[model samples]
Target: MHDQPPIPGRRGFIRQVAGTALLGTGLAACTSTASHGDNNDNTGPLRFAHGVASGDPLTDRIILWTRVTPGQDNGGGDIAVRWQLATDAAMRSVVASGTLTTSAHQDYTVKVDAAGLLPGHVYHYQFETGVAKSPVGRTKTLPRMDVRQVKLAVFSCSNYPFGFFNVYADAALQGDLDAALHLGDYIYEYESTGYGAEQGKQLDRVSEPRDVLLRLEDYRRRYAQYRSDPDLQAVHAAMPFIAVWDDHEIADDTWRDGSLDHKTSAYGPFKLRKLAAATAYHEWMPIRTPDPAAIDRIYRSFDFGSIVSLHMLDTRVIGRDQQLMMSSYFDANKQFDEARYRSDLYSPRRQMMGAEQMAWLDRQVEQSTARWQMLGQQVLMARMEYPKAVVLGECSSTAYVAAKRRAALDPASVTDQERRWLASPSLPCYLDSWDGYQSERERLFAIMERHRKNMVVLAGDTHNAWASDLFDANGRQVGVEFATPGVTSPGMEGGQPQRNPDDVAAMMTDMIAPLYYAQTSKRGYLVVTATHEQVRCDFRFVDTVQQHQYTAAVERSLRTLAGPGNRKLEECPPV
Candidate 1:
C-alpha cells in the first residue's frame, strides 16, 4: 500500500515557521526594511503605510492594521500609529487601545489583533498618526454561537476594468454587515488594455503597468495599480475586509503547476510566476500566507464569538489543477482515467488543496464546535450547469474531438471523470470552477459527512448572485451556498448587469429549484449574518456603480436555518 503524505497539525506549522524561510526568502528579509528616500511625517501623517486597513474579522475583535512608509520606497520605513476601537458611534467610551510600531520590513504594515470583547457588537475606530488621523471607521463583531442572528457581505471576482466597485461602495453605506468576506479574484493581473476574458470590454479602471504580470515587479505594479482605484480605496476606508484570491491574482484558472492561458513554456514558467504572484500578494493584501516550507499552513479558522466559525479556504495556490471540462471520456464507474484524462485537468499530480492542506481542512471542519460553520471561499462550491452537448459536442467540436482522443491515449488520466459531461447539466461552459475537479469534490463530501456539521458556503466569482442547496454524493441535501454578486466586476449580463434585469433573476429562480434564488447585472454585495439557528443573507444592490457613493438598494433577502442544511428563501434571523 502506498503511504500518503502525513498531515501536519498546527504545531508542525509553528516548527516549520521557526525553521525555514518558507519561500526561500530568508526570515530576516520577511521582516526586513528597505530605506525610503526621506521621512515626511513629522506630524501624524494621515497617510500611513499604503493605507489603513484591517482583516481576518472575528467575533470578539478584528485585526487592526496600518503601515507607515518612509517615503517613496515601500520596503522600509517606520512610524507609530495609535489605534482605538470604541462601542459608540460618537467614538466615546474607548474599548481597545494600542500603539503599533511600523518597520521597514513587512512593507511597514502593522497588524495587531485586538481580542477579549463583547460578541455581536458594532464598533467605531480611528487611526492616529502624529497629527493626521484616518477617517472614522466602523466594524461589527461576530456573534457567539448561541446568538441567533448575524450578517455578512460576501463578494468575489472583482475586476477593476469591468467597472467601478459600486457594490463595495454601496455595501459601505447600507451599514448592517457583521463583516464582509471577499472570496478572491480581488484583482486581475491583465495588461492595462485587458487580456484574456477581460480583453473585449471597455475598461473601467486602468492600472499603472500595462502588461501581464510574470515577475515580482509586474505583480507589485498590478497590486499598486488596483490600490489606486478611488472607489476601491473608499471601500477599504469604509470597512475591514476578509479576503482571499481566485486565478486572476496570478493568471486565469491557475493550478499548482499550470494555468489555462499560461503554459509552462509561455510565461517563462509556473514556479517563477507563482513566486511573483505570491510575493506580491503577501506585500499587498491584508491577509496571510505561510512561509514556503509552511505552505501547508494558510487555511485558518476564525471564531465569530461562540456562534460561528469562519473558515477561509486557500483553493487556488496551495494545490489545485486548472479546472477541466467534462466533455471528454471516462470509464464504467464514472471515473476519468487520470492518465487518459488529457488537458490540464488530467495531470495525476493536480491537486486542489494539495494533500496536506486538504487533510488540515478536514480537521478544521471536524473540530469546529460553533453553531454555524461557514467557508468563506473564492469560487462556486455547489455544482454549476454547463451544456456539455453544446459546449463540447458542438461549439468547439473538431478541436474538442482531437483533444479528447489525445487525452484518452495519455497514461495520466486513468479513472478521471473525462466523460462526466454527458451527465452534467446543459448550460454555457464556465471553465474556471469546481465542475473541473469531481474527484476532489467527492473527497470533500466524505469529510463533511464524517463531521455531520451544518455547513454554509459563501462565495463570489461568476460576478453574479445565486443561492444554492448543496447535495452530497447520494444527492442528499448537505449544505447551502450563497454567492454574492461582484462589487464592480462585469457579469455574464454583459457590462450592464442591471440592464433588462427584469427577467434574469426570475428565470434563474425558475430553472434551478435547489438554486432557488438569484440576481444578476446588479452591482452590490450580500450582507450575511449567521446565528445558532439560522444564517441570513441580504442581497444589497446599488443603483449605479459608475461613481463613488454609499447608497445601495436592498434588492432581495434569503435565509437558511439549521433544520437539514438546505437553504430556504426568507428574511434572515434578526440580531
Candidate 2:
C-alpha cells in the first residue's frame, strides 16, 4: 500500500512518504489572536481569519495552510491567495513562493506543499490576499542527516466546551519544539447540549451550529470555531503539527463501517456522514493526504535524520472492526458469558489496523535504521484490564477501598464474598482500545521484537496521564508507553468527584502490573524529547481549565532508555 507519486500541477507538490513510496496526494496561544474575517463594514477586504499553519514536514517540503474569508459585499467566489516561505521572520529572504486559488467549495481554506527548501532550518510563512496578510507562522523541515535530539509537544482530546485552551497557550509560549503531535480527538463531535455543554455555557465557549455535526458545512463550522481560539491559533503560528484523527473527529466510537454516535435513521447513511467529516478534516487541517482517493488512509511515517523514525498510525477509522461490547456477552439473567467474550476478544479476525496497515507497519519497522522507533498514535497500547468485579460494577471504588483497609487491619474479618470480588479475574477497562484487539496488538509487538528495535509509543484519548511497560502475551517487554493527558477533557476524577484523585491514581497503579505512573485528575499535555540515549516525557498540567488565566507546572517526568534489553520507564526528578 505504497503512496502513489505526488499529483501533477498546483496540487502536485503534495507527496505521501511512509516506508518507501512517495505518494502524490494531496496551536494556540493566549498571546496571539485569530481574526474570524468578520467585517462590520460589508465592503472590507479579504482576511486571513484562521491565521497561518504548516505541517507534515519532509526534508525538502512542508504543507502550509490558511483560510480566506470574504467580506459580505465581495460575494461567494474564488479568490487567489499568494504564499511565501522565507528564512527570516521579516520575509527579507524568500525561498519558496506560490499562488493558489481557494473558493467556498473548500470553505475558502488554502493548503500548499512548499517544496525546494533546506533541511533542519527554521522558516517563516504567511498567506496573502490583496493587502490582507496572515499572521507570520514558524515551521521547520526535518533534519536530513545525523540529529542529536527532537522535541515534540503532544496533545489530544480538546473538547471545545470543556474549558479554556491554556495547555496550548503554555506550549506555544515555550517556543522550543520541533513540532506538535496531536493524537486524535482534536475536535469533539458533540452538540451544544452534549459532552462539555454545561462547562461551555459557563466559559462562553458553546459549540457552533448548536447540533451534532452530520454534514460537511457542520464539521467545517466546528473546526472554524475551534481554530478561532486565541490559544489554539498561537500554537499553530508557533510551529508545525503532525495530527491524526481519533473517533471524535467524525463521531464517537467510530469504526470502519459505522460509529456509535451516528444514527442512520436520523443522520442519513453513515458513509455519507463519514465522507463529509473526512473532507472537512483534510480541508481545515494542515495535513497532506497520503492517498487523496482514500481520504481515510492517513497512516504515515517521518524520519528525523538517523535519530528517530516517527510513525503516525491510524488506529481509529482506516481499518478498525466494530468494538466488542460486554453487554453482548451477557445472557437473559445477566449471567456472564466469559468463554464467548474471551473467544471474540482474542479472535484473529478482530482487527485494529486490518491487514494492509499491519503490513505497512511491518515494512516500516523492518526498513527503519533509526535509533528510536516511535509511534505517535491514539489510544493506549498497554494492558489496562481491571478486576472483573470492578469492571462489572459489582465492586465499587469505595467498597474496594474499605475492603482493602479492613483486610489490612484484620485479615480474619474479611468476608468470602469480599475476597472473591477483590480477587476476580481481570477484564479490559475499555474494549474500544487495543485491549479489544489483543491478537492484532501481539502482531505489532512481534514486529518490534523481530526487528529488535527500541520502541516508544506516545498515546492519548484516556484524558489521563499514564506511564506503562508494554509486554507481549509471553510476558516479554516489547517497549514502553507514555500517554498524554487530555488538553482540556476531564480525567478519572471527573467521574468520581467524591473520592480523592490521588487515591484513585494510587489504586490504579497498584492494580495494574504494567502501570508505573498514573495521574488521573489533571488536564494537560506531554513534551517528549527523544535523543540517542533515551526518550523523556515531561507530563505538564495546568492548574485549571475552568478559566482563561491559569498556571501550569510539570507534574511528572519519566524516561525510557534506548537499547535492546531496556524497555521500561523510570521516573525522573521533576524539572
Candidate 3:
C-alpha cells in the first residue's frame, strides 16, 4: 500500500542482489566455519542450513523454501537448486520433485511450490545446491476438508537482540504442529541496547543494520541480521509459518501519520520514511501486497474448510492514528506543554483496520461457511482496564471501586488502583492497545454480533499470554481472545515485581474476571487446537527465557460455540 521507489541504476543492483544475500538463503561455503557471514556466492560450494520449509497450507500441496550458501561473495552462482518431497523421509516414493535456479538475484533462497501432494499427509522434503546436500525438513499440507483437528503453534515478537530463540527450539522439539503462524515482529528494528531491555547474554548477532531503518538497504540489512540467528533459522526450517506484522518491523508505534521513533515531528511533508518501511515490508515478507479494496488493505481470508476459516488482519498502516504514547493522566502533564504528547485516543476517525479493512472483514465473516471463524491478527480485542480510576476529572461512580486494589505487584509496577487512587498519573498507564481505537473495536464486536455466528480471535505481539472472554457492547458474551506471548521479548510484568505466576494470576483474575488467565513474565508460544465443538488455546510457557535451554508448561483456555451471541470462554489449569 505504498509507492515503490523508482528503479535507479544503483538501486537496480540492490534489488538485483535481493534474491540470495538479502534473505540469507544462498551460501556457498558454510554457515558453520564462516559463522553466518555475508558470503553470498552464486556458484560453487553452495551449502546452507535451516532446511526446507513450507507454508500457506492448501489441500494438495504447500510452498517449500530454503537458502543455499554459494561462495565468498557472489551470493551463489546461477546454480540450479533441486528439491524432493516424498511421503517418507528417506524418499521411498517420490511424491513431488522439482529443480529451480538460484542466483545472487534472490539471495540464494530457493522457494518452490510443490504440487501433486496428497492433502493431510506428512511429507519429508529436502533441498540440494549442486553437490552440497542440505538438511531434510518435515512439512505437511493442510488437511482435506473432512479433517477434524488442526493444531498449530502460534507465536510472534522474536527479537534476536533479546536472546537465543529457545522458544523456537522448543516448538521444533515438540514435533507436533500442523502449521506455525508467526504473527509479525519476526525481527526487531533496533540495534543493540536501543530497545529498553537486553537479554541475559549478548544477542548472538547484531542487526545487518548498524542504525535505524530509513532506506531500502537499511531495512534489507535488518532482515539479514535477524535471519543470521541460528535458532530462528532452525525454526524456519522446522515448520511452515503463516505470518503478519505489527509495528517495530518498521518502527515503533507507526500509523498513517509517521512513527514514534521519528525525531523531527516535521515528517508530514514528504512521508519518505513511512513509505520506505511499507515497501521493505512487502519486499521482504511473504505477504501479498496490501489490496486497498479490502479496506486499509491486508484483510484477507484463509479457508481451512468447514471447520475453521482464518481472516488475518493487518493492524498497522492504513487508518490507524499515530499511537498514543501516554495515558490521559500521563498526557495531562505533557498536554500542558508538549504538543506531541497531547493525543486523542477517542478520535472518531482513527481506525484499527480502517474503513476498507473493516468492510472486508464484514463480508468475510458473513459469507464464511466454516463452523469456526478465527481472526488471526495483532493487538488485544477485549477492553483492557488500566489502573486509571478517573473518568475525565471525576471519579468512577461505578461499582469498579474494588478495581483499584492494586496487585501486591513486584512492587515495581504502578497498579491501576495505585494510579486512580493515588492520582499517580503514571500508574497503570495503558494507551498503547486497542483501547486507542475504541470506536473501531466497538465496530468489530458489532459485526460479530450481526453475523449470528461464533468467532474466535487469535493475537500476539504483547509478549505476555492472556485469555479473555470477549463481551459485546451490551456487556454480553460474544467471543473469546487468545493472546500469545512473545518468543524472546519480555512482557510488561516480567519478574520485575517478582511474584509467583499463580499469585499474579490471581491478582489479574480479581482485577478482571473476563480476563480469565494471564502470565506476565514468561517466554514461549501458544499451541491452539480447534475442533467443531471447542477451540482450546494452550498458552505454553517456557521455564525461563534468559537461558538457552528451557521447558514449556501450558495454561489451557477453552471456548464453546453454542450459537452466535452465546459464545462462552474460560481459562483453567491445564488438564
**Local accuracy of candidate 2 as per-residue lDDT tens digits, 1-575:** 22222222111111110001011110122322322321212255789767788999999999999998777655777899999999999998998898999988898889999999899999999889987899999999999767899999999989878888888888888777999999999998899998888988887888887899999989988898888787888898899999999989999889999987678988899999999999999998999999999999999999998888999999999899998776677689867788888999999999999899999999998999898999999988999776677656676645665676688899889999889877787776467789889999999999999999999999998777889999999999989999988898876664446656666666666566798888767788999998889899988887778877676777677899988768789876445
Q: Indicate which candidate wins on lDDT.
A: 2
List per-prediction Cα lDDT, in the order shown: 0.60, 0.82, 0.63
Q: Write the per-residue lDDT of candidate 3 for residues 395-497, one digit (tens) a residue.
A: 3312223334422434445555445454423221244467667677888888878887778888876776777888764777878888887887767453224
Regions of model 3 farther than 4 Å from truth: 1-44, 73-77, 196-205, 264-298, 325-344, 390-429, 494-503, 571-575
Tens digit per residue, CA lDDT, model 1, 115-158: 87677677777777676566666766566556655566777877
Off by over 4 Å in 2: 1-43, 398-419, 573-575
Per-candidate TM-scores read: 0.73, 0.91, 0.79
* CA displacement after TM-score superposition, residue 192 of candidate 2 (Å): 1.2
Best model per TM-score: 2
lDDT of 3 at 299: 58
- Which rank order by lDDT, best down to worst? 2, 3, 1
Candidate 2 local distance difference test against the native: 0.82
